[model samples]
Target: MIELEGLTKRYGEKVAVNHLTFTVRPGVVTGFLGPNGAGKSTTMRMLLGLDHPTAGDVRIDGRHYEQIRHPLKYIGALLDAKAMHGGRSAFNHLLCLAQSNGIPKSRVAEVLDTVGLTAVARKKAKGFSLGMGQRLGIAGALLGDPQILMFDEPVNGLDPEGIHWIRNLMKGLAAQGRTVFVSSHLMSEMALTADHLVVIGQGRLLADTSMADFIRENSRSYVRLRSPQQERLRDVLGQAGVPAVEAGSGILEVDGARSELIGELAAEHHLVLHELSPQQASLEEAFMQLTAESVEYHAHSDTGPPDTNGWAGGTGTEAVSGGGWGEQWAREQRKRKAGG
Candidate 1:
């Protein structure tokens, strides 16, 4: 288990991590998520003692990492895949680490096989591709066979097959009662792999909860309806105290209203229903919504506003524009104050 108590890090005048406190228990895969510059990497660095925290403490299995005797035997981490010496062969790299940590050389081949890098164990790491480099990193982390593993963006730059492999490996490790904590920007992948989520924004804790609870709390459920008499339907829904927004021509998105009620309303109004479907916000959307202002970077399309044109036809788009609970609440408040 890993526990962080009021962990904080600051660089000059800017605070990178602010009094962050959380516990990662064993036998579960916990996902760490945040936007760029939200201090995720900083927090991970502090945990591994790569960077010193200005305040607070981090404990691994009831002991600080710096205080642990033979620390590799209890905790393992993959901070950077490219941190290895490029000239060293895969086998040599693992051998050096094992030797320094008092690990037997036999375990080197074992970990190489585990990461499926045995074929290229003799090859120089400089010749490895991005995916291969990641595998090598994972092998090094597993060399100690530690009970606690932390991987930061493990699936970045990986192909679909490699991504799936990493996902399964994390789950398998957690199944064996190991504490598996990974950080990633891919919410879709996290949704499939993580049982718990720890979200942060602007160096502050936004949420720490189970995956199901986080989704249920942050996501908004609504029904999209399209009818010939769109204005009439809007008026009817408004009169019924149902919040709605006109979503382009002949389409309306109704919130806090059930599909059954929508059907009954349509029937009573004799409206020509062209389309009606329920929509649930995705994890990616919730993440964006929660950290909109905390996003250090924003990508703008060349054409214009994103909603103007369906470049690839709605199939490739993500739900909720990175605005999570905080943004959603702020938007609601603004609307209410404006008499929306």
Candidate 2:
């Protein structure tokens, strides 16, 4: 299990990560989501001991990451798929990690086969494609057969088949009571893979809840009705004290009413209905609804051509600059260099 208590990170005047506190328990895939510049990458860096937090604490299995003798055996992470020596072969890469962490050399081949990269194990890292690099990174993460795994944008360069494989792989690991924490911007894939969600915005925690509850609470749910007898249906719903708004194309949408209830009402009124379906908001819609204000970048639609500022039909500071999040990182790096 991974636990964070009052975790915070600050670089000069900017708060990269606020006091975030959440528990990523075993036996389920907990998805991490946030808008651009929301401090997601910073938080992950701190969790893996890649960066020091300015305040608070984080632990893996009741111990700090630095204190663990063999961290790979306890918690494995894939923060950056391309973070490897380009000249090294995939097999050598995994072998080196295994050697340092006291993992068996034979386990290298097992993970290579597990990620379907056995054929390319002898190839140099620079020669591999993005998807192949992703598989190699995953193989390294599984080298120690750790109980907890964390992946960030694992499907960034994967094809459909690779995506499906990784999705099921994470589920299979969690089924064995392993803790799986993943961060991704692909809401559709996340909706399919994650059982729970941890959302943050502008370095602050916005939500930590089950997937179903998060969507239901943040989005509108309604029943869509389509009928040939539109007028009769509207009258029936009105008389029954259920408000329905017309949605063109001979369709009516009723809020706070179940499909079964509406179907029974139509039946009692002797009305002919063509469609009666419950419409729940999708995960993407729910995410937008919750983080609308927290969005750091904005794109505007206009009839004119794009402006020199790179933002379409807009000018001034309000326009989204190219250096959105990178500006913050550049400042942080400069501060570090000066302090050093």
Candidate 3:
């Protein structure tokens, strides 16, 4: 289990993380969510003892990261895929980590095969693609067979098959009562993988709740009804004190009403209903609504309608982020390369 209590970090005048208090219990995949530059990377760095927090406490299990004799065996993390030495072979890389962490040398082969990197075990790290590097990083994380696993953008460069494998892998690990905490920009993937969510904005705790509860509370829910007897259905609903707005195409949307109740009412009125379904917003939609105010970066589309000629207009299309931690990190890397 991972615990954070009043955790805070600052850089000069800018607060990167602030007063975060939460417990990531075992047996669930807890998702960490935030907008661009909302201090997610910073928080993860603190958890690994890579960066010092200005205040409060963060622990792996019941002790600090450094206090653990074999930290990797207790908690394995994949923070940056490019963290390995480019000069070393994949096998050599894992061998070195295992040697230092008291892990068995045979475990390196097991993890390499686990990540499907056994074929490229002797290949130089520099020659690997981004996806291959990600796999290697994951293999290193699994080298210790830790009970607690933390991943940030594990699917950044993976193919669909790899994504599916990792998703099931995390679930399998959690099924064995392991603590899995993952951070990803892929909301669709997160929605499928995470059982709970921990959302933060501007370094402050925004929400920590179950996945179903988070979406239901942050997004709109309604019932859509369609019937052959539209007029009679409207009349019955009106008389029954259930206000439903016409959504065109013979569809009626009722807010704050259950589909079962609507179906029962229609049945009582002997209405021939074609459709009665409950509509709830997705995880991405709910996330946008909850963090609408907290989003530090915004993307603007073309002022005019989309070009119907199969071409994009405006200067160019940009992703919905500018100052996100990943972008900033890339910028720093470029600066360092230029300086070198």
Pairs of residues clashing in candidate 1: 288-322, 288-323, 289-322, 289-323, 289-324, 290-323, 290-324
- Candidate 1 C-alpha lDDT tens digits along 1-340: 9999999998998788999999999999999987556688899888888899999999888887788777777888988899899999999999998997899999999999998999999999999999999999999899899999999899987889999999999999999999999987678889999999998875888889999998888887889998888888888888888867987876789885398998898899888889888888888766665554343232231222223122111234444344332332344355588995
**Residue 253 accuracy (lDDT) in model 1:** 91
**Candidate 2: residue 314 lDDT (0-100):** 22
Runs in model 2 lying further than 4 Å from the true structure: 293-340
lDDT of 1: 0.82
Instruction: Pick out the ten consecutive residues of candidate 2 with the lowest summed lDDT.
Output: 306-315
**RMSD (Å) of each candidate, 1 decimal:** 8.3, 7.2, 7.0
In candidate 3, which residue pairs get closer than 3 Å at backbone N, Cα or C atoms, i.e. clash? none
Each candidate's lDDT (Cα)? 0.82, 0.83, 0.82
Say which candidate scores most in TM-score: 2
Query: By summed lDDT, which 10 consecutive residues of candidate 3 come out lowest?
Result: 306-315
Q: What is residue 188's positional error in candidate 1, in angstroms?
A: 2.8
Please give the RMSD of candidate 1 to the true structure. 8.3
| Model 3 CA deviation exceeding 4 Å by range | 228-232, 248-250, 268-270, 293-340
Q: Encode model 2's per-residue lDDT on 54-114: one tens digit a residue.
A: 9999999999899999989988888888999999999999999999999999999999999
